[model samples]
Target: EAGVAQSPRYKIIEKRQSVAFWCNPISGHATLYWYQQILGQGPKLLIQFQNNGVVDDSQLPKDRFSAERLKGVDSTLKIQPAKLEDSAVYLCASSKGWGQIPGGSGNTIYFGEGSWLTVV
Candidate 1:
């Protein structure tokens, strides 16, 4: 099966600038997620979508970060007025469904190579 796809693998921008990253998840998957991974830290959940509807976004910084999954297939994440602290790898992941434990039978979450961002 094809893996998740992401674009603009690397980016550098000045603080307070804006940037958007795009993602296309694995075909047929119904759950998509966006995570922010700071250097030396685990990826943190930023938003989640079940098909075209949002499942969770409490961790998202609504004032500056926004995301959308359109038509249940592709997604986009944007950070406006980006801050130096916003520098991190933005990861796109997909799964067949929710409530499936990691490493469990027939349950796997596939991840993209991630879009790397550097705020200067």
Candidate 2:
């Protein structure tokens, strides 16, 4: 039972450059999500994927940020023409279902060691 996996644990780029992050969710998980966390704020959901289709992305910045889950498995998130505000940790998380948490009735989201991004 492995947790989610992410790469390029840290990244730094000048504003206007492009960056991408990758994630591979745990096996048997049915839902995946991408979140953005600025230093002083809690993580904000950027995108949600149920299987290979997008469940929600209303908060995602369409002009520069994009994400996809392939074949209901691996996922990727990209940011182009990066802005200084985009400096944050990109977190990848997954869950089994609504009642899958241990000793709890709610889903337990498992998060990856976030991909840290710094825009200069």
Candidate 3:
């Protein structure tokens, strides 16, 4: 079986510039997520998608960050007019179910190599 997350191992962008990241989730997985991890801080959820529908995006910077899941398969995350604070690793993750939910019995989530970005 193939791994849960794949491709787009890294990326770097200048401040105020735009950049995008892509991910291909594992087969049969129903939940996908994008997270941002800055130096010295834990990963923060940027967005969460169930199939092709958005489940969460409250933590995302609406003016600069955006994401979409296509046909319940692949996903893309983009940052426009990125800020210096956006310098970090963009991680793509997936799981069979959302364990974050109460008593959901979700499986262990898997993360990709992550796209690294630097606002310069």
Clashing pairs in 3: none
- Candidate 1's clash total is 0
Give the 10-residue window scoring lowest on summed lDDT in candidate 2.
96-105
lDDT of 2 by residue, 1-120 (tens): 899999889999999999999999989988999999999999999999988988889999999999988789989999999999999999999988534457767877999999999999
RMSD of candidate 3 to the truth, in angstroms, is 2.2
- Residue 19 in model 3: shift from native, Å? 0.3
Give the runs in model 3 whose Cα sits over 4 Å from its true position: 99-104
The C-alpha TM-scores of every prediction are 0.93, 0.92, 0.89
What are the lDDT scores of the predictions, listed in order? Answer: 0.95, 0.93, 0.86
Q: How well is each residue in 1-120 modelled by candidate 3, as lDDT tens digits?
A: 676564456666678899888888888889999999998999999899999999999999999899988799989998898999898988899988765667565478888888888888
What TM-score, to 2 decimals, does candidate 3 have?
0.89
Worst 10 residues of 1 by lDDT: 99-108
Better of 1 and 3 by lDDT: 1
User: How high is the lDDT of residue 15 in model 3?
Assistant: 83
